[model samples]
Target chain A: MACHELIEGHLQALARSLPASVVEELRDGLIESYEDQLERLGDAEAAAHAAIADFGDADTVTAAFVRASPGRGIAVRLLLAGPVVGLSWAAALIAGHWWTWPISPPLRLAVGLVLGLAVLMLIVAVRERHHYRTVRLAALAGATGVAVLDTTLLATVVMLPAGPSVLLVPALAASVARVLLVVRAVPEMISDP
Target chain B: MRAEALKGHLDGLLLAALEDGPRHGYAVKEALRDATDGKLDLPTGTVYPALHRLEQAGLISGSWVVVAGRRRRTYELTEDGRRSLKGARDNWQEFAAVVSTALRGAPWPATS
Candidate 1:
């Protein structure tokens, strides 16, 4: 069997679940396994069958890749939790009349950039267009961005005159929770396959 | 054996596969199958992800190579991988010994 013919169907089945690079690698792997089997089995048809069988089912393989890569999951999670975290901070900001506070320009710009990065991460993670590496990078960037943003925001909140007050409590708690979650996810983010 | 049966030890088995030398993904699968005499016939999906995980941990590294007119990814153990394998070997020996002793001393189960 031609190598491409041997694994084309498998790759197509895996197209949605895995990145292009991984799919390409898997294609090569399947073909190689088929060729090896052919040498032993001495029949092209049987070799193809054995090779695919040896690689296992598409869903099972997809799950394995998903387990190995935390990029998409992290991005989805951060994005999903975004509005709640933002709203909590917003409620506190409004309650405390934060607009009247002397917030630094660069700090605001930093927040904007981090928010933009979060948006980009969402698109990259949800799209099938990017490779696993890009997804991982976007996710890591998103996580790190959120963690820094939360920590910085928390620090600024603490410095305010109404620090730790009832009005600011929700914002403070949200930032702290986000920071903790990011800390726990750092290992998974870096565990690139 | 079932794929789940090899979960914790799969990494160790994969690391051992590379102990002899670098091999491509399929070759590694063949080596394991040969070593276990088909007992280790793994779920085809299970092996690659495990290899990736090992690579992430810095225990193994993969590179592309041309073989017989085709490009393939080959993997080899790193220094860390070697040390880890040594540790795994020692641990497995001790574990197997204890289990062997325990099982050896147990009375045979009566036929159901």
Candidate 2:
């Protein structure tokens, strides 16, 4: 039997926040329940409304799902890794240029500010409050920091007639890779409804 | 009753609903309603998360079962769940007695 519009919409909303396997089982249960209600009430439309009302709204249900889900493990790992990775890249950049051109205090200050904000957001993410918000902000800040630091390093490598050290080349490559990951993730994370 | 009133008691109610045998999410909801004489109404969506939480806590177990040509997830109580339910029932009884006595201003011991 086809699902009622309201029932389908509610299930879809839940699927947005819950794992697909959980949602698949939930969908079946909902359909079966709705069918029973339809038989009892002898009216499909009324049964759908009753089912939805009895079930509660999508927001309440999804909130509970998120709170119970183990899905935040990846987010936790990313946030926990953020500062360590950022600092490693910073150390490499400093080693490469701190003695020669000194990379300008203003640029250094900007990187520090972004990294600080990223760390703060990461703290919030770890605490599990406003989870997706904190994770998104931290990822965005981390990505911006990567962009700023990488651009400065690349420019230094190019304009410095001395060129960068072979040792620093690997660190710079690693920063590029991190930048790609953060950039790829930001869109997906921020676009989450 | 309201959802807020039922919130703390929901875990026990869910365990009790599954006490007889394994049941799907919707069936559990229906059992809760029927047991409460339709007084314990809540949004149906909320039960799924509660079930997941119980499963995570190791009080209940869930799996997919085919029913009426469709797949549904059914939940059953573990030994732990049964023990917890007994504890919950005892606690509710004591709590209700305290509230009822206080409300009626009745003495603990009857005097003629």
Candidate 3:
């Protein structure tokens, strides 16, 4: 069969199994690929057909299309959960110390913002690290850890006596770790196997 | 054929295909074959993913149409697609020129 006919046949088959919009998009993309190839080789239909026969099996193409469509991963789910859990813990920590009202309010607000930012960064890191299995998971863990540390620091700053801000050590450490994890994950996430 | 190699020039080819008006997938393939005199050889399956990516990026829009008792997906260039096509065409021309000159062992021009 002609290359176009072959594609049309596959597209028709795909339409039977997939959503209309998705099938349509796939069809259009396939057509665009045909046009692009036709422009490059000039009168090479037989060669095109052979190439398609060798490399353009319907199953392989469909699999690639499905993979390219961006399914959510564990990292994404963790990213979503991280913020909710982090903020809830931060809120609870602040609320648990009502006796220290005057001092607690400002500290609570500050910690909330810091925790929120950390959570947001975690979410971004997960997204940016979508491809790396280990690094993405590690970044998620680190983000959660930082959020926990921030919550603890808020409580410490509110309840402790005059002392050096020693909690800064772990807080900074966790933030750096999250950033490093995200950076490492980026290249892996973008590299298509 | 690796689609990655063609990625740089796809927008132009797609836009140029659409300049005649919207066309469905099969028709686009046929039109491109006629236009190129059959030089380029792309697999039919590969185009669909690229089309979806383009649509997602807002370079093209598509709709379903019934023709001759079959449903086919038709596509057209968006305004953004046109702009992208122009940019891609210009860039491709410059790139092709440089590559051609280099292949022919010509000195690179200091300025175009």
For each candidate, what TM-score against the reference? 0.67, 0.61, 0.48
Per-residue lDDT of candidate 1, residues A120-164 (tens digit): 876676563425566777777878888888887887777878544
Off by over 4 Å in 2: A71-193, B107-112
**Lowest lDDT 10-residue stretch of candidate 1 chain A:** A125-134
Report the Cα lDDT for residue A8, model 2.
89
- Candidate 1 docking DockQ: 0.41
lDDT of 3 by residue, A102-164 (tens): 555775677667666655555554444223333444444545545455446555645665234
In model 3, the Cα lDDT at residue A159 comes to: 63
List model 2 lDDT by residue over A9-80, tens digit each.
988887765556767877886787788889999999999887777677767766666565432333465565
Residue pairs with colliding backbones in model 1 are: A54-B44, A55-B44
In order, what DockQ does each candidate have? 0.41, 0.48, 0.17
**Cα lDDT of model 2 by residue, B22-99, tens digit:** 988888888988988988765677888789879867899987777767778888999999999999999999999989
The recovered share of true contacts, given per candidate in order, is 0.66, 0.80, 0.37
The i-RMS of every model, in angstroms, reads 1.7, 1.3, 4.8
Residue lDDT tens for model 3, B72-104:
677898999888888888888999997888899
For all predictions, the C-alpha RMSD in Å is: 7.2, 10.0, 11.6
Count of residue pairs whose backbone atoms collide, per candidate = 2, 5, 17
| Clashing pairs in model 2, backbone N/Cα/C closer than 3 A | A54-B44, A55-B43, A55-B44, A56-B43, B1-B39
